[model samples]
Target: MKRSLEFFPVQLFAVIMGLSGLTIAFAKAWHFLNINYFEAIYKVLLLLDTILFFVVFMTYIFKWIKYPEAVKKEFNHPVKSSFAAAISISFLLISIAYYDYAPSVSIIFWWVGAPLHLFFTYKVMKFWIEHKFEVGHINPAWFIPIVGNVLIPVVGVDAQPEMVNIFFYAIGIFFWLVLFTIVIYRMIFHNPLGKRLLPTFFILIAPPAVGFISYFRITFGLIDTDSLFLYFIALFIFVLLLTMFRQFIKLQFFISWWAYTFPMAALTIATILMDSAYDTNLTYYGALFLLAVTTLLVAYVTYKTFIAINNHKICIPEEE
Candidate 1:
């Protein structure tokens, strides 16, 4: 009760991220495949995602009020600080999910999420500049802030001017390149990620996948050499991760496992978009395969999450 409220984690917002991404992925599948069941599933998930956003947001709000120090500690934390952007990313994901069904409400979320995400980007970049973080502190989760920037254009193309969307798109793509190098370098030169953080390796798939989707949105669905490169880069990473499946399967679950969901959703959506543009059997079947995987992974993670909650495994003191 009160203890749980005090221990409520900001990272819990990633659940909304996973759920919102699943909703949008299904919505895209319905649009492309015209599958009747996809529509109902997406609609239900959207409503549930909306409800969960407020629940997690309000819980963190109370936690912030009661334990400002805890909130501040997370904000200053090298790894946890990256997840603060998940709160803004959740809002943006909901905006994209609602764009078709409720544009008016979607714009309101975009308006709030866009600016807040920019603020987080600035705050995090500033933190990195001011603090003396070791290479050991870097991980794929660092991509979270950068990924949110490119995502702006998914709905921003219609909600705001083209230049505004491009502004965000540029920031996202550029930083993604910079950070990708850093993360890869860290992995090659330093120790491998710990068990709890290993799942965040999946985040490596997000920036390029989201970049592909955002690029098409900014260009009004104009497929070109650059767009193909972005999509393929993401696809290659997805395949690379599959080769490591045995490694991932052996690890114990952590809240960070939610990191697996949204990026797969982004890549699934990108594959669907490529199918829509090129009308190829390869992309079409690829999209469906990825969609199924994303759905199953999200469901499994959600089930594990609830079990952890019920067992009081979550919202307890952090493991050393």
Candidate 2:
């Protein structure tokens, strides 16, 4: 088999777009540190994230079309490829809606993309279970898109309609549970160490962390003063922090460190929103400290990521 430098462009494009989205997300969080600039920064970040999503999705689509068989063979299940295509199309539709001035296309894209993304998620989960892939390992590759879709309606775009919110949240929670089960399984069985541990730790903790926040926000207005949603949010937050501490001690630092920005930011926003309903001071402080530490870690990892990318070491070799 022959390898060429041509493979690097696609990977480079994906990484650049992904990191740009991360940078925007982190900027939004940094702005929140002052409170006064939060809304402005958030709006900017949301727009930037949407753009970044489009670029990354386009890159993936190109790769899918270019190397269909190769990509399909990477997964044990064939449905995974179709589901991935569905996700890319959904994101593309949504991104176009965000930029389009006409109401008809915007509404059409919104309606189409939302349901397709949910369906894609369902199929993906089904594939995971049927194939018996170790779901609990918490790798960043899977976690990022899950969290991104959940946030797209909440933070990256306008508030979704109540019906849409309920639909997405319900489907989102179901998929999240599947992901959670897999992560816990990996933690128990694999006991991942070294570099693998970093992405796995983030994948394990961040989904539930963000899911809890999104669920609370969606249910906040409709529910009563003493709703179960609040309790669920609190419980998930507790689990997230506990997992973070354990992973930190294990020294699974790079991906776990840099990846905290998006999750912690979402948690902080949720805490602020639920301040009146719950005692959120600890969550607030915890998110703040984690955000600070994650910034420093991301800076270091970023330098390393750049070197690795240039040297074509971004994709890890699968163990025998």
Candidate 3:
């Protein structure tokens, strides 16, 4: 009972930090603030997120080390705990590297953290396959790494030319596709009911949208053109918007609203990248418009969420 209670705060902190980091990244990427001021604010937020990463990391390590056998027994799975640890440490090292301090420590931690993340990601997928976990449920384990993958590049860590970085990105794309495929299959064929349905769909589509955006920027030189990529991205954004409208009418708006912010932000970035590839004015303007609109929408939802949480109205149904 004591151990179970302890897990709640760590998990809550991670989720909150993940959401905050993504919000900051979108603001920075969209040039919402003046250059000098934005850089200062961005750095501060990154630092706070980095500190939270360590707190969550150390908490997990303590839990695992203290009750290794119990952890293995309870979940009947070691991979989730292992992946959570890898993701936390990776965030810490990447944060240090981005700030350009502590080179020796950063390099060592980077080397250790990256491969462990890749290995643990694979292990988690294997566990999912072995156990046949349901698609509708959000696996709390993947939460940190998913956010880290998107935010790390924006943090300015010059990951190019590093084989480990390349491999990590590649494997990340693969796992994202696999998980996304499973969710879509479940939605269409199995038709999971109740609250899980919509949240599951939002989560399914988000990673690919994010993965495509990340790869487009990171692998620009490797790919011939980004135009082809943007077309599919725009399609996904439309689908997601339509889905969200359906949910809103049903009066099921909850934290799932935050899901739209990341992908819409990605679509905006992808449009900019596409313009660089093709140099079309329409694409450039369209991307800018989308970015502005999405930012406003996200700001509104964030306000609503703040109000809901403050008034103690943010209720997520308990998982069975």
Candidate 4:
């Protein structure tokens, strides 16, 4: 097999998912801002995302067909296989993105993604139970499937059985805490993460943000004490990661860095939801501040990525 095609990793799916999800998140933010051109911006994003999504999807399908052994290696690796959930998550977000445009169509994608996500959750957790435990190997990627559970309700409440969606929500909320504790413990006691994996630490910002957004959706947009808890927790994590900016900036750019994008988008979207629902002056400004920060970070990442790609720096097999 040619090196270029062989170098593609299933984890690269994260890029499409993260970028598409960010587009949707920013779409919501612009709508909230009553931007005059929000519709055009959103439609363009949806179009671009649709094209990229299918191209990557087909590329992966071909990889699996042509290189089954390589696929097996990735699936067997504890850390890499956890990323398979990103495929389903991408489907879920694609479903959500199209939810309003053609709800019946969206339901089809949701069903397709949701069942696969359930299976992924089972497979990954089973590996943990059946394999030898290692504290150091734990990474935020473990939270990917669990976070998808929490996120199911965000769109599932509209597309599927309410009980099923609520079940997903409960699972997400429970394990998010469980995994957060273990991951944080590992981070504090273990050596620093490898440079390439450093961007994934930003994933810590996501669960609370997504959980807060899901809580708002489940409650049908009511404000309450739990809302306060989720929002404040997300805010704290955002600030915590922000304070460690030097660590992120010093690291060389890589596709994994795109992992940092959607979490911030989730954080931004959470604040926007709070602002609209709670009618708080602070939340109003807070949303814009987070928006600015997320926008700048994403822009910088995109710019560096373009530079890297032009220089052929991103296609390295070791990094993938």
Candidate 5:
């Protein structure tokens, strides 16, 4: 326990991000399809997501109290620092989940999460400006901070004014493009990511996915050209990553494997929104397919994660 506490990582919060996303994805399914089964699963997931969030949040707090230096080191790490945003993103996602069940509580989380994420965005961008980084340091995880910004409008559309959410939406969309270019350059020209970090390639699907949803929220659920553009870009990346499944399957388990979950959830949710708009058989079945894939993917990763934890594979020192 001491060893685990000493090396406890901020990336653990990604679990909350993934679970929150899955919970929301199912909630959307229940809302649109009116499937009683999905509704039950959605409620159960909400309960479990709430509990998991507290567990991960409290554990990280303990780690911070006991190992402040370790926390600081990760906060300063070029690659790892981006993951710290997952903490705020978790808060934002949980806020989205609770919006229907409890608006007041949702607003509380939104208030806490939105500002904190902006702070992280500022800090991370400042770090980028202040430091000199090699191309090898770039990866899809760099999109995390921007993804959090895109997420604001999901719940913020209801919790706050339009301009506020739009403000965040603009920032997210612009930076996503910029960072997407840089990360793609690194992937094509530089060496491949380590097996452990390879799952982050799935993150390439998130910004546009979340952007599609946020655009829907901002436009009163209207499917426009821009929304279609965002959705198809996300869909293309989703297909692109699927073709690499053989490579991903061969890699050993790493906590970084959780990277596969939230982005899948984002695309799943976006597809569900698309179904809501089109009301076509193809969109409906497509959403269902992606939802099943997202759910099973998350379940498998969760199982592997627990196995790794039981075998004492997580929360130990790494080579960085």
Candidate 6:
């Protein structure tokens, strides 16, 4: 029993954030479908998300208290520590969903989450500068901390001060461009991502997708040409990444595949939001197509997760 009590790594919180976001996206898609049962699934998934937050949050808290070295290991790891940002993003996503029905609870979480998120971002940036890591060190995962800040405004408009949301949004967009340039440069001049990290390339799609949604929400539903530009940029990179599907399939499965889920879901949600805001028929069809694709992909990940667990492929100490 004590052996079983060992905490799972905090990095695994990425799975919770990804699943919660996907659940919310599914709810939104169902709404677009005009499914009478949409509200039922939406609420059920929101409850599921809340339960997950508590479970994972407590699990990691146990690690923080019992296994200080584990936390140190992650924090010092150049690649792994940034994933800690997932915890903050998880809170933000849940707070966004929570605001739909419980404004007070949502506001409390947002106030707490936004500062923690920026602090985490600051630490990661500090680490990067101190280490003086070069362009060759860049990866899709680098975006996790920065991109998450921009995501704040998704719920910040209702939960945080306007200027606070704008500040983070500006930081998010600026670093997104800076990091994108470096990541693209590294990919062109260096060797390809190893199998374990290749799935993270899908992360390339997330910034612009989430950016589109955050921009729309923060601008109070403005759908200008700049908005269209953002959406298309996401759409283009999403297609660009799809070309690697076969390469990804040929590689063995790893937990990093979870990296693929949220971006797909984000793009799906962006499609639905674009359609609703612009009332464009083409975007409506596009939203349906993206939703179908996201559903199928998530189902596959779920099937593989159970199989991986039975095989004892997960739930083990990870290599640095």
* lDDT values for all models: 0.90, 0.46, 0.48, 0.79, 0.90, 0.80
lDDT of 2 by residue, 259-317 (tens): 43434434444444344344367745655555555445445656766665566554443
RMSD of each: 1.4, 6.1, 5.8, 2.0, 1.2, 2.3
Candidate 4 to native Cα RMSD, angstroms:
2.0
Ranking by TM-score: 5, 1, 4, 6, 3, 2
Report the C-alpha displacement of residue 142, candidate 2, in angstroms.
6.2
* Candidate 3 lDDT, 199-287, residue by residue in tens: 32334434554455556546643334443553475556567657567564564545545545545555555555555566576866776
Ranking of predictions according to lDDT:
5, 1, 6, 4, 3, 2
Number of backbone collisions per candidate: 0, 4, 0, 0, 0, 0
Determine the C-alpha RMSD for candidate 6 after optimal superposition of all C-alphas: 2.3
Give the poorly placed runs of model 5, Cα more than 4 Å off. Answer: none
lDDT of 1 by residue, 77-171 (tens): 99999999998998899999998689999999999999999999999999999999988999998998766799999999888888899999999
Error of 4 at 7 (Å): 2.0
Who is ahead in lDDT, 2 or 3? 3
Error of 4 at 196 (Å): 1.1
Q: List the residue pairs that clash in candidate 3.
A: none
- Model 5 TM-score is 0.98
lDDT string for model 6 (92-208, tens) is: 877877765577877877877788899999999988878866554578998999878988898789866889889999999889999899889889999877788888898888898
Which lDDT value does model 1 have at 62? 86
Question: Which portions of model 3 show Cα errors greater than 4 Å?
Answer: 1-113, 133-162, 217-223, 249-258, 276-281, 297-317
Clash pairs, candidate 5, are: none
- Please give, for residues 213-242, the per-residue lDDT of candidate 5 as tens digits: 999999888899999999999999988888
Clash pairs detected, candidate 2: 135-182, 136-182, 136-183, 138-200
lDDT computed for candidate 4: 0.79
> Per-residue lDDT for 166-253 in model 4, tens only?
8998998899999999989989999877887889888888888888888888888876898778778878987888899899889887
